[model samples]
Target: MSIKSFAAKIFAGYIRKKIDNWASRPVEVQEKVFRKLIKKGRSTKFGKDHDFLNISNHKEFAEKVPVRDYEELRFYVDKMVAGEPDILWPGKPLYYAKTSGTTSGAKYIPLTRDSMPTHIEAARNAILCYIAETGNSRFVDGKMIFLQGSPEMEEKNGVKLGRLSGIVAHYVPAYLQRNRLPSWETNCIEDWESKVDAIVEETRNENMTVISGIPSWVQMYFENLKARTGKPVGELFPNFNLFIYGGVNYEPYRAKFENLIGRKVDSIELFPASEGFFAFQDKQNEKGMLLQLNSGIFYEFIKADEFFEEKPKRLTIGEVETGVNYVLIISSTAGLWAYNIGDTVQFTSLSPYRVIVSGRIKHFISAFGEHVIAKEVEEAMQEATSSTGARITEFSVAPQITPEGDELPYHEWFIEFEKEPENMDVFRDVLDKTLQEQNSYYFDLIEGKILQKLKISTMPANGFQDYMRSIGKLGGQNKLPRLSNDRKIAEQLEKIKKQ
Candidate 1:
């Protein structure tokens, strides 16, 4: 083995041992994090206003600080943005991660001096864990490409502001600096199409071994590469074997990706956000990402079904159970207290506190009392495609509450297929059956005749891409929702289909 690979193996072993030590004592580590966060929070303006000084434990803390989404917490965030000190965390934030907000125009999530390193560390440890498990540190010596946003920053009250990925780009370890692909000028291109073209040109002939990004954007890059070289990505970059991704589940895009690469590659899934780096896949054979219990964030879970109740019980790490979906609330060193990040997660393993990002709390279809989540739909799609030998490029689900003629309202699946199923009726049946098996409410609805079996509408080539482009969110950390309760997205897909 090369010198770099030999050193990587030693480092990976050390990191893996450290991770195992903490993962074994999940609740104890979390309690320590809680105490540290509370101590720091006591000094902030929000801490003072919320009576953080008097809070002694989780119960008191919960009572003192109600869970607040971005809109509810804007009062304090606005102060932080306006150059106020100690409004949320302590002192001014080091940076503000700018992201699109649903009701609020743009959210500026603070990244404090204490909290920023956790993001970088979590990402680094994920790779180390993979290397330790698989004994595959040779990828360390090869070129790596992280398709991401521009590193360009705008300042707000002395705080650097940019997309989370852009901010992270600045923190890539020194050792990997020479190995990282796409020159800085190419990454700074404002337009995603141009950026991808530049990236393709720059990295097409390089010895790329690891590529990281959201699956959709990476798919675009792969397509562009194939178009240019007339060869599958794996053939062009023989050393490429590790695929690291975050932001969205990669299962739905797996088939198309395998086809583009002409082979299967091992992948690491990450559960990260602007608020904090929460979890990363620590085991290649495991079912879920290892929850970052020792990170500088204290976690709270409200059962997703009861999330909207007047007062839902917030459970700590010690009180959670497997197979239950919960709204992930967090109080972090970043200065967010009882903050709702809007994502829902389910524990797949409690011994080491591993979790799967189940879906977004707001992104579900319950128009007919059948609460179907993103996980169920994605899994159903996976099962149907696997069974039928079909390859899908992208898809989204929405409730069709109104249907013409005598047909009952049903779920409308807008799907973009790379290889259409030979028997589409059979494909649709398998999709519907798999969803019903996973979600009992939907099963009940189907059995009671309240809703009909789901229908599929094949999207034209690049239909989803066109929709995203139209909305000005075509690339760089933006992903379409897997499902929506309302018809806003469904109606738009209809227009794209007709076109």
Candidate 2:
């Protein structure tokens, strides 16, 4: 590694020490520290310039800065794209993380230098906590795997276009960049046809120690790993020690991953988003996730009912309660004041500020732990239908829970298309297989109790799209809803099934 990269790791280690010192404190001390940090956040340069920072004190600030959603951030993004920073902070942002939207259409989440440290620090602490809990100290020694987007830069000389992941690669610590298993530029699975297959090939025989990234992608890798290697993951990489996953729940995907590896793997849940890393799983079981609040952003939580019923009421770390879900809001140096990230979480304990991701406030699915929030389910369906070599034009998923008499709840997938899916049965099987593999709870529930079927319907090619358009949701920032809470959606789907 270059001297600069080595220096970066040292700097990160210093930051980790400080995090440990603070985190090691009693709950009361942590709360006191949190208050001091909030006050400091209010006095920071970003707070001074923005009107949103006008609260008289931290207490008042927490009370007044209502919880916000992505829609609120979209307004700022619009201004940022137009070259207006809105005085929320100093300096221009680097780029936006292009993520799929839930209630809205596609979203371009802004990422800036000042705001990135939280993500960096949180990720680092997550590693530290994992080490603390697992007592396996060989973090830097083994091959690590990250299933993620291509790191290809978007544009070089304004000519060839690439991916955003590559751009962020430049900012990673040099040591990490070198140790990263898949070389960013050389190993991207750009050709849509060979993506999963290629990923499986890339991971084979690497003597991997750590694994990370989105659950869906990891599931794909494991499935293909089993196919190509003829051995489950545990047999293939006996040295694998830790599973670091985020971007979705680990519970639903846990059993299958363990089964693939053929052994128990220590795991950590991370809460990194395009914007920043908010919190990470605590080292102790039953201790809620620990928020890296002191790193880069100031956090505020809105009570569950208040967040839903009226303008959200923000609570500082001191006022937070145990076992109740709250909407997460952050004010970051990256120029966002009072930004509401869509996730909802519940605190399990206070001393360490441990929390669990409960659900999304809106536009997210609550069933199957598929992480099938509005956007992911849409993207997966689109990808599957397009790649299946079938003429499928539309689809939906309604989560159903059977009464207590039944063993498990069923997830009814509604499909509508002109022609029967070319390899209809195979496609259905693929869909079921993929969902179960991607979502652990779905897999476990299915194996244990729920015997859901892949329900298919034949409609005109545009039938589903036409219905979405009729609902006045065809255009900008909208999508046909999937993973509905009410059984009415399934009932409607059944009508289409019978048609």
Top model by lDDT, which number?
1
CA deviation > 4 Å runs, candidate 2: 1-17, 24-54, 59-66, 155-168, 191-193, 284-287, 363-483, 486-499
- Per-residue CA lDDT of model 2 for 268-311, tens digit only, reads 88877776677888664664577765655667788755765755
With candidate 1 superimposed using the best TM-score fit, by how many Å does residue 291's alpha carbon deviate from the native? 0.4
RMSD of each: 0.7, 10.2
lDDT of each candidate versus the true structure: 0.94, 0.60
The residue pairs in collision within model 1 are none
Runs off by more than 4 Å, candidate 1: none
Q: Candidate 1 at 144: error in angstroms?
A: 0.3
Error of 2 at 93 (Å): 0.9
> Where does candidate 1 have its weakest 10-residue lDDT segment?
490-499
TM-score of 2: 0.67
lDDT (0-100) at residue 207 of candidate 1? 99
